[model samples]
Target: MAVEVVSGIVLGSREYGERGMVVQLYTRELGRVGVMSYAGRGNDGAKLSPFLRVLSTVRVALRLGRHAEGMPKLVDVEEWERGAQRGWSCEKMVVGCFIGELIQRLLEERVPNEDFYLFLLERLGLFAAETQDEVVFLMVFLLDLAKSLGYAPQGEYTVSNRYFDVAHGAFCGRGEGEGADVIAGADAAVWGRLLDGHYLADLHDVDGSQRCRVLYQELRYLEVHSGLRLSLRSLEVLKELVG
Candidate 1:
């Protein structure tokens, strides 16, 4: 097969055969793809372990594999960019992990959407250099990703409509099924603005609990619409860091 060059960040990996790995990436062109690496140390595939490790960026040439119909094999690769990943604070790393996990779980395989890819790449760039906005950053990411992936909730929050429903992707009034898993009150308001693409400065002032509530509500909305579940292992650590 012909070589196709793509640029992206390593999402995560799992051990394959005894000496192999299936490394997944969210790419600018290919969306989400996995490349097989069984080459011994010092070889092309093995060289990727370090570069692909820890959220580093890479540009790689991949060709369709013989064994799998769609999976590709790593041919030639180069570090597309560096230093930014190393410079991210421990907290930012957790955010990065959350972003990576979200990207991996939400994106379908092989399909490509350059707009979503660039949007993701740009956000990672912001998270690297920007600080004190981590929670809002995650909130914005969830909003953007939701919209980009068609999970964005509709409607505005108002005094009468005090609840935002996740499954329905819209705001509703009390007794209108504010039931379990719904975002209510100020949290709902904030999420409503987030879904509307409004990033008011006041968003930065919301206290930890409100911040947590809005964040989790947006997350549930995203997950519910996407039908994806996340372990979110880094979430508590991330919350502590941001707070």
Candidate 2:
């Protein structure tokens, strides 16, 4: 059997049957991979399933097949950096879930993007370590995630050309069209600040409501540009937590 060890983040985990566990993990080596992650069958399956929680950062050894016949099998887990550990508060878990869902939705399987994986791992580790009472962490994470995904917004935001076109992914003098593509006036200005290389660590003073609005707009921008209609269920919960 071909075997390899990799650092991975668990995007999602679910039970299959009486004693089956499956996980979707994004790794630096292989990108998004679905694996039947059972260290043992029957009652002994409890040994490893407890550690493979969603949003956990883990080092896993996978048993690979000679031919690409089916999904790989997780044979051993060396380390588990769980996001929802014993001391983790509800807010931390919520942020982890929201970001996990967004990444899982935005990323496609088998697309090997090393930069994206590293970006996610670094920010995931950071977010896991700190729990804040604001939405800045989420927004900061979005900025990196957007850049990693190759759509960190384009053009500059100015008074004469202030409208943000989500579909075009650039600011314009006036929006090219109506619908989700157009964001104008104060809202557009807020987006420009939030996304226009003006990260929180730089210069930003957005309040709770403005932050939440920018979050919504960021999601919309991603949806329009990613070629997928994103419906992040955790978004509303994240918004409520921040708003």
Q: Which candidate number would show the highest TM-score if scored against the true structure?
A: 1
Give the clashing residue pairs of candidate 2, or none.
Answer: none
Q: Candidate 1 residues 92-149, lDDT tens each?
A: 4445545655565555332335566556566555655655556677887788878877
Alpha carbon lDDT of each predicted model: 0.54, 0.53
Off by over 4 Å in 2: 1-89, 108-110, 131-134, 175-177, 196-205, 228-232
Clashes per candidate (backbone, < 3 Å) = 0, 0
Which lDDT tens digits does candidate 2 get at residues 39-152?
223332223343343335333222322225443332322223332354655455455545554655554422425566556666655665654442667776675666677887
TM-score between model 1 and native: 0.61
Model 1: weakest 10-residue lDDT segment is 15-24
